[model samples]
Target: MSAQHPRPGITHDNRFFWEGLAQHKLLIQRCTSCHRLQHPPAPMCPGCHCFEMEAIEASGRGTVHSFVVAHHPPIPPFEYPNVIVLVELEEGTRLVSRLVGTPPDEVAIGMAVAVEFEQVADDFVLHRFRSAASR
Candidate 1:
């Protein structure tokens, strides 16, 4: 990971998610009232409109639901042709993250992937995806 890589802004609604990553765990938010899972943590459950929420550990397994290779307008602290992916987790929720350790051209929809954690800074960690077949 690059030292200059962008860091996530930790907030109360998603603090648990970030903390889980630091501990190398994939955590997802589940509505306590409706028992439905959601990502990009929100203050209230979208389905049941309930404020009750809880965190659940995910299997760290998912499939590539969608992806894109960024090759234009090179950005700093990031490599060219970065593979950004929308991974559909086994828990039925999706996470938007980067695909690492695999060639950009090799990425495909429905490709099995597993979560991998990287400590980008002393106090911060990020979740990334890798081909599950390689595990």
Candidate 2:
């Protein structure tokens, strides 16, 4: 039902991030050898190409570094005029997710945001953002 909520393509490299979301936690991969943070979960660290990595729990807080108001090319399971944001996490990694609980015009660069999870299906959850000022 509801297109099965589109499960993520999990792999050995990124399983930790997905499992962490199932536990309602946000995790980023840190190169245990080089001490740099990475998102989208690369198998090798870009800094030193180390295959070793560790999970770090993110603060679940970030600032709006950039955003775009998507008004065209509607897709199923999502509303049009979506407010998409590129958030720079407190840990310094940037991620793109939909921004909620704030108007598109109200969103601005440097605005603080906090992570929130929404269950799109019984077995899947998605990360979204809301203004921290709304917290």
Candidate 3:
């Protein structure tokens, strides 16, 4: 089946990330200068201001730093009463996503999470965070 919702924000930096998701991989930008990894990929490293960078696949492991339960309605294509979260990856980068496989009230700081992708369109997929099934 194809994705249900598609919001393509294609750019030079993030194009790889989105493309990687379509293949079930999580890609992040790594700075060649300081060796720091960054999400929301950029051409320049915020750490050393270096233009040298490369794309690397991540382990897709992270922890929930913060989150909110969407009691109110969400934007189009998103159902209400969902959990959106700011996840801190083990690589030290934080990404925003929806939480799955857990109750809203059960979400807490430092809760272990893994990557989950939903194909919301034919050519696009969204990355969401979810607690491990063993939890």
Candidate 4:
């Protein structure tokens, strides 16, 4: 999709994560106190209940933990039969993102995937997963 796609709402907590994606990097939040990795950056560490956190670069390699193919109620700026996936990253954190470059029938749980960046607009970029073997 292009600029017509809905843009992500950038905020203080997630700015770094989004910025990293624009640079073709996957950034995951880590709790400084417990060293636990987390996705969807939060204000505090879930494991230690601490506010100290840091961003760490991820390997961008993961396995498909789960997925779904949406074929009904198609939305604009998004392809139908979209393959949405929950990926368990090598870093021990999970991220929910779209899967691309593979057909829906081909997607399988525990499938190896690697992160890929798509420039949806001049100032916007999104991270998606694709078959690691295809890379």
**Best TM-score goes to which candidate?**
4
- How far residue 132's Cα lies from its native spot in candidate 4, in Å, is 0.9
**For model 3, what is the alpha-carbon lDDT of residue 117?**
82
- Candidate 3 wrongly placed segments (more than 4 Å): 1-6, 133-135
Which candidate do you rate higher for TM-score, 2 or 3?
2
Candidates' lDDT values, in order? 0.92, 0.89, 0.84, 0.92
Off by over 4 Å in 2: 1-4
TM-score of each: 0.95, 0.94, 0.89, 0.95
Q: Give the alpha carbon lDDT tens digit for every residue of 1-135 in model 4.
A: 342989788888899998998899999999989999988998988788999889999999999999999998888889979999999999898999999999999999999999999998888889999999898
- lDDT tens digits, residue span 1-135, model 2: 334455789899989988888888989999999899988899999999999999999989999999999987876677767999999999989888999988888999999999998888777778899999988
Query: What digit string (tens of lDDT, one per residue) describes model 3 on residues 19-135?
Result: 899998888889988899888888899989999988888888999999989876556667767999999988888888899878888889899999988887677778888896545
**Clashing residue pairs found in predicted model 3:** 3-119, 3-120, 3-121, 4-120, 5-120
CA deviation > 4 Å runs, candidate 1: 1-3
Ranking by TM-score: 4, 1, 2, 3
Error of 1 at 2 (Å): 6.6
Q: What is the lDDT of residue 113 in candidate 4?
A: 99
TM value for model 2: 0.94
Put down candidate 1 lDDT per residue, 17-115, tens digits, no spaces. 999998999999999999999999999998989999999999999999999999988888777789999999999999999999899989989999999
lDDT of 4 at 28: 96
Clashes per candidate (backbone, < 3 Å): 0, 0, 5, 0
